[model samples]
Target: MELSNINWMLGAACLLAGIGLGVLGYHLMNAGARNAQMLRQRLAERDRQLAELRDGVGEHFERLGSLAAALNKEVGEATSRLAVEAPHRPDLAAATATMPEPEEAATTSDDVAAPRDYADGNRGTLSEDFGLKQADGDAPQPPRY
Candidate 1:
């Protein structure tokens, strides 16, 4: 009878330990499942926002393309009208017909002033006389060595 009692007690202890471990493992698994579900929800929300942004950008580009096409059509019509009226203006015709010869109007060496000798007191000769032309003033002082 004593040996049977010992065996029964040992079996009860083992069963209780197994039940406690099972409860702990169940709690851990439930926590992990909850975290994974939250992450999945956040990912779905982000994907929806990205889709909306892509659609808005596509619409904006479409509007820009339409505006550009309208502007190009207007420009083409204006250019054609200018071309038709250009030959009727007498002033414009004369200006275009008598373009001046560049060689005949070229500047000669006499038009530009020659280089002056700075060795004498003619340092201010090339400078503009600001109408205070006091040419009979004292001679310039010599440069220091």
Candidate 2:
């Protein structure tokens, strides 16, 4: 009787262990699937957000184009008005007629200073040996502790 009971208990424990292992293995096998589904969801969400951003940018550019068109129309009207009025106004026409001569507009070499590249003579940042440390051969070396 005792032998039979021991055999039955052993069989039950083995069955329970097998069920536990099977459950664990099933979870392990499908782990990648769960992660893949989550990634797909995130990708879809990002795509939706990107579509919304593109739409907003398109609308903003449309608004800007309309404003630029309006501004250009106003500027053209103003220029046309000025052209019609300039012929009647002798003072405005006279000012436009008097253009400065090329010789008068020319600047002498002495008037304009040449561009400088360095801050100082040899110690400037642009010099090749500016940042290098000088070797001290005469100084005694201290012993390291």
Candidate 3:
């Protein structure tokens, strides 16, 4: 009878241990599942944000392309108008009509020398007239209030 009681006590202890282990295992599995769900949700949100950013960038590039094309068309129209109107100016008409073709003009040295005098003369006069000073020079005294 003593041996039987000892065996029964050991069996009860083992059963209690097994039940505690099972509860612990169940709680661990539940926590892991919750963590996995949270990770999946985060990944989904990130993917959505990336998709939105990609779409926005695509739209921005498309708008830039459209604006560039519009600018090009306007520039072309303006160039045509200038070409048409340039000959109508009385002062410019004679000069334009008498001007040699580009191929003929390229063979002459006159075009290259035309602006030499203009560029050489009064190069520094504008800055002097404007009273502009270089930063390396002595600082001008501040005006008294």
Candidate 4:
């Protein structure tokens, strides 16, 4: 028997339903990918922050060590000076003798360079012309651009 008109209508409806379901499935997959990308971005940001924190901690420890060494040297020097000035006080001399020499400290006062706000001269690190190169004895020229 020949197919009826109602059969074609049913086939068309089924095709439309399949297309709609495929579209929905593709959208869901894309949504999942977007969520995964967001999670990855957050993880990377967290890692960067953790790295910065670690660097900060390392710098803090370095400064702490230097400060401790300087304090130790200063105390030793003070103790020695006090012992010399007050020779009658044998206790002060004993204390000075008991203290370690300043040279024995991990770092000396001369080793730790003090922070300088001003440049040493025209070619110092903080100077504007420090890194710039030009011909010898040449005056400053205007920007090429």
Candidate 5:
């Protein structure tokens, strides 16, 4: 090729390449902006949902507190009424009365007998009785499948 024609071709190729790179860069930047906008919208929606949930929980706690207070008031009134009426009823008198002490014979049963010790029941091999050791000549063989 001629030297001037070669130079012209190189310059045209560089120009084409520069234009392609610029277009690609612009599209990529616009795509990033679109993605950022979408993420911001999702974040705003999540924030709104969280605020609603917080309000709902606050209302629930208020209701629970009121219910507990009412229950306490009702229980106090019932307890006072029971205390006033208990002495007038005959059936409740036995249950409400103080207990009597037992005779001396009942408390001496543990002292009369000594506690007996037993061997542990879970330590031996499966083939032998749990509390007994296996004989040296009589080891159990594994079963065939």
Candidate 6:
């Protein structure tokens, strides 16, 4: 009878230990599952924020492109209006005539004073002065070094 009671006590202790271990293991597994779920929620929220940022950037770029196009169109229209308004001015008429688009007038050399002809008549001597002065049909050289 004494041996049987000892055996029963040992069996009860083992059963209690097994039940405690099972409860502890179940709580640990539940905690791990909750942590994984929280991680997944955080990742989803981050993805949503990234998408919103991308959309905002795209909208900003679109607005910038539209603004650039508007500015270019306004500049073109203003230039056209100015050309139409001042059609008879010598410079304006010259610009419109498109005859080899006359090479830019040469800068005056420092050695020569402003021409007397330019003073009397508002037009500067462009090709005529150089043509008369050239020796043997060579291009005229600037007077100053």
- Angstrom error of the Cα, residue 145, model 5: value is 17
- The estimated TM-scores of all candidates read 0.47, 0.54, 0.48, 0.49, 0.46, 0.48
TM-score of 1: 0.47
In the range 2-113, model 1's lDDT, one tens digit per residue, is 9999999999999999999999999999999999999999999999999999999999999999999999999999999889877654678778779875664566644876
Q: Please count the clashing residue pairs in each candidate, in the order shown.
A: 0, 0, 0, 0, 0, 0
TM-score of 4: 0.49
Worst lDDT 10-window in candidate 1: 116-125
Question: Residues 50-137, candidate 4, lDDT per residue (tens digit)?
Answer: 9999999999999999999999999999999998897563578779899888764656676889997666566768666675666778
- Model 3, 10-101: lDDT tens digits are 99999999999999999999999999999999999999999999999999999999999999999999999998888653697779899767
Candidate 2 lDDT, tens digit per residue, 11-52? 999999999999999999889989999999999999999999
- Model 4 spans > 4 angstroms off: 1-18, 87-145
lDDT of 6 by residue, 12-95 (tens): 999999999999999999999999999999999999999999999999999999999999999999999998897664686667
Residue 136 displacement in candidate 4 (angstroms): 99
Per-residue error for 42 in candidate 6, Å, reads 1.3
Worst 10 residues of 2 by lDDT: 101-110
- Model 6 scores a C-alpha lDDT of 0.82
Clashing pairs in 5: none
TM-score of 5: 0.46
lDDT of 2 at 141: 62
The candidate with the higher TM-score, 2 or 6, is 2
